[model samples]
Target: MTAPSKQTVCIVDDDAQVRRFLAEVLASVGLVAEQHASGEDFMRRWQPGKAACVLLDIRMPRISGPEVHDWLRDREPGLPVIFLTGHADVTTAVRAMRLGAFDFIEKPFNVQQLIERVNQAVRLATDKSAAGSGNDGWQRALTRREREVLRGIIDGKRSKLIAAELGISERTVESHRASIMAKAGASNAAQLAAMAAGQPPLD
Candidate 1:
């Protein structure tokens, strides 16, 4: 039998140095890292269903990371996208996460953390591909309140913020969050966010 192909991680950044460094790091972990010098370059070269995950730089020229993410959402809804942002870009990154990004890593990130997040993203992508429409069951099982709380969590909102928005107590929001996780079989918010990607809007 032929061996399974390595998972590909596409790194889209304006800085050549950043792309090279990320390529080296991902390669060290047995992942195939495809580097793109700019968002436009990535857009041109990217093919649907080609990459398991994307490491997108948030502050790129022209297309920008969020813009590229929008394109990805429309084209490859199931592909995980992890934004690479600087300290100042954290807010923007969080907003992107709300829109279905897998996760975000701030600049000067720990190598181990990056590897863990990337691995998680790859696993999520692989599981999603294998499951096909299987995820629909869990999604259908979520209560409307659970779904609303889940949308807040995926948006990177704090429990307090979600509570305020929903006009419920923080404890209530936490309860909904726990229920959502249990129903979705997700151990954490990141996994929940990944599973929710491309799903219908909770609203």
Candidate 2:
């Protein structure tokens, strides 16, 4: 069978063995893998296209994964980033997620889970690229809380249910819903949900 895309899975880790293992795993799943010894090396080769996703080691000499992620945020915001960490901490995971990391996995990650997240990220990035420009504006306009509410709504949850899930009051959820609709320029809940799911708004 053919590979998913010609784009490569760029792995940035200081350890040679880890890089080798990850490359092998990705190959088994029909993904092209490219290795870099450090963040600087990866940055030197980074380009806008043909990168399915980045597997970045959290700790590296000189430029760290978080720093690389920050740079990518400005240079290539559409690129998906997945952090690899030897020491998994709540603080680090939360921070990485906040910065748009697809997912964070520890050193001894489950092979299945790793493949799943990587493939999922690749698919999501591909969809975003295929979607063109309409989704970007709505995505950028949403606040974090509004995003959470939109997700719940998209999952077919009621406003009260979404509020409970987010640990906020229903009124707050309603307010967020209103703000999200305004920002997305969606006429109704259905249209707002469509916009959140990366579909173009209806006329």
Candidate 3:
């Protein structure tokens, strides 16, 4: 069993079956799971500083996912939220992204994809907790391309491979890498990687 201190992948959906299925999926990958039936219920039960990330349903009774996200931004900004929507639209997706949701995925989502995203979110939460609040500002400083490069670096790709994957030159990849390091206030690649993973730099 996961200890109480272990991070949980929390699911907030109105449908009981969906919640059960999600919980089971998370368990299949050895991740701890928590579930709530509605947004209001989740908000009422949620405690600040818990080691958890939320998989929020877009449409729910009492409060919507975006509404809950707004509330969380003010209360537990460190908690990462990923939106799950059965009826996805451009406007809703845009709004969710604008509000800083970790990611907005459509329902009937691929199981593997969902698991991967959950794993990434959990890693992010763990990092944020370890790195302290200043890390959030560094993350926000990255541009879209720089963010992609940072992820590539975290995946252990070299500049050459990242360039090929991103369809850019090796020189361009290096430039992006340097920019990411600077924006993250990292003096070396190791420190930048630690920052990207939300870990405090090693002394």
Candidate 4:
């Protein structure tokens, strides 16, 4: 869980007391806390690889929490966010999940529960970092041309359409696809699509 010493956290919420309360609790655990009053403030100061997690309020006066998440999605911070929702919903929660929030904590969460969930989220983020290092070799296994061909295959393109785009023969496209499927351990278009999207092998 990053040894607790090296991790920094950000508590982003509009409420002054929310920020202070979070900051104190985090300090008690030997982690760093940098508080911000709004999503924009957090985004302005945020560095990509620095923080471990964000305790963000889902509602704020300007630059709401969900927008802040969308901004960070491309940044790909090691930071996993546990959202604070004053008015939680099935649809809003689902959107947050789809956008890759670590967890959704309803308002008035217990101190121990928040701490436990944060610890779990940090562990997950660290595991993802560890696993990525081992897959560096596969990162370059496919050439640019091969990737484009794979995309076509996943899109259910006929060999002729792919070939015409790449200025290659349909037979050549087929041959390249065969090689791709074998290397990716995929049996069909759906499998190929999953691989292309960087997903794990389907059961």
Candidate 5:
């Protein structure tokens, strides 16, 4: 089989050791790593259509990871972002995911798992680029109610909880979930979530 073309994974963190360690790990798996010492440095160098995915540290010296993510959302909506966070930042990381982050990994991460998520993010970015405009078509096809259900799903809410919050029945929530998956051409929640990374922020 032919080898895949190397893709760059941008590592934006204040810690030099973390960046170097992550770069080495990514390199071991045939991926190239681009290191940035801080979020400010990353923002200065970043442009649209660069890097397969970003490994962003949640807490940086300046222009924190969430801030960078917000900037990316406007300019490079299709680019995948995987937050690197500590245990205390898990809540913030989950909020980021709800707001369209590709994924988040806690510090002292598992090397193999991190590699797997990065590869998935890269594939997602490639697919989005190939699809030309990401999930806009299907996202546009969704009704306002469906969008609400999708937001709940992206927020990691269970059907019963979503139903309660939305003042709908559990069955209705499930139906909306099914319709969402169908519209997104996703077979499961994870696939739907991956595609949701490209979806616009729900009102």
Candidate 6:
């Protein structure tokens, strides 16, 4: 019998035992884990195209997970990361979430849940990278007035300030913002900003 081809996963941690255990867990489910000793080690030999998802340890000997996350964000912003932490605090989890981590999982967690999130992250990455389709659908989805409102949103103007700038009511500005969020498939103002950053600012 032949073995199934492994889906590559990059595991970065300073502990040999932890790496081996993670590698073993991945291999159990027909996935392959490439172990790196530190954030520096992973960066030096980072291959962007191969790995499906990077499972990173938040606390390492030298470079930390958040640092590596920043590095990847600057270099390959599309890369997906799932942070593995021994210390799970509200602040840490919130910070990691803001930093675009797929999930912040504490140590001694259910192996199955971790794998499930990793699989979903891989799929999301695939979908987001595959086809962005047309910006026209997105543009047409916004009303003329909404586009005008969006310009201020992209320019970092507050809703009240935007209303004052455009000689409109704050309620009207909020309505346009809601419309913009729905049209762009973005959940929050920051997500709208990210989507706008991927395109030209509304003219």
TM-score of each: 0.69, 0.68, 0.65, 0.64, 0.67, 0.64
Top-scoring candidate (TM-score): 1
Candidate 3 per-residue lDDT over residues 106-170, each given as its tens digit: 87879989988788767666554454456466566556887788888888888889999999987
The lDDT per prediction is: 0.78, 0.74, 0.72, 0.67, 0.78, 0.71
Q: Distance (Å) between predicted and true CA of 126, model 6? A: 2.2
Model 1 clashing residue pairs (backbone) = none
Cα lDDT tens digits for candidate 5, 61-166: 7589999988876676556688999999998987776556777899998999999989877765555445444546667656799899888888888989999999
Q: Arrange candidates, best lDDT first.
A: 1, 5, 2, 3, 6, 4
TM-score of 1: 0.69
Query: Which is the winner by lDDT between candidate 2 and candidate 6?
Result: 2
- Cα lDDT over the full model 3: 0.72
Give candidate 6 regions above 4 Å deviation: 1-6, 88-90, 132-194, 197-203
Q: By TM-score, how accurate is candidate 2?
A: 0.68
Q: Model 5 lDDT vs. the true structure? A: 0.78
Model 4 poorest 10 in a row by lDDT: 131-140
**Which 10 consecutive positions of candidate 6 have the poorest summed lDDT?**
1-10
TM-score of 3: 0.65
Tens digit of lDDT per residue, candidate 2, span 1-203? Answer: 22355358999999999999999999998889999999999989887776878999988999988988878766765576788987755357546654456677887879999999888767656555554466556555556787788788788799889988889988677656654553444545776667567543232
Question: Is 3 or 5 the stronger prediction by TM-score?
Answer: 5
Q: Which lDDT value does model 3 have at 1?
A: 29
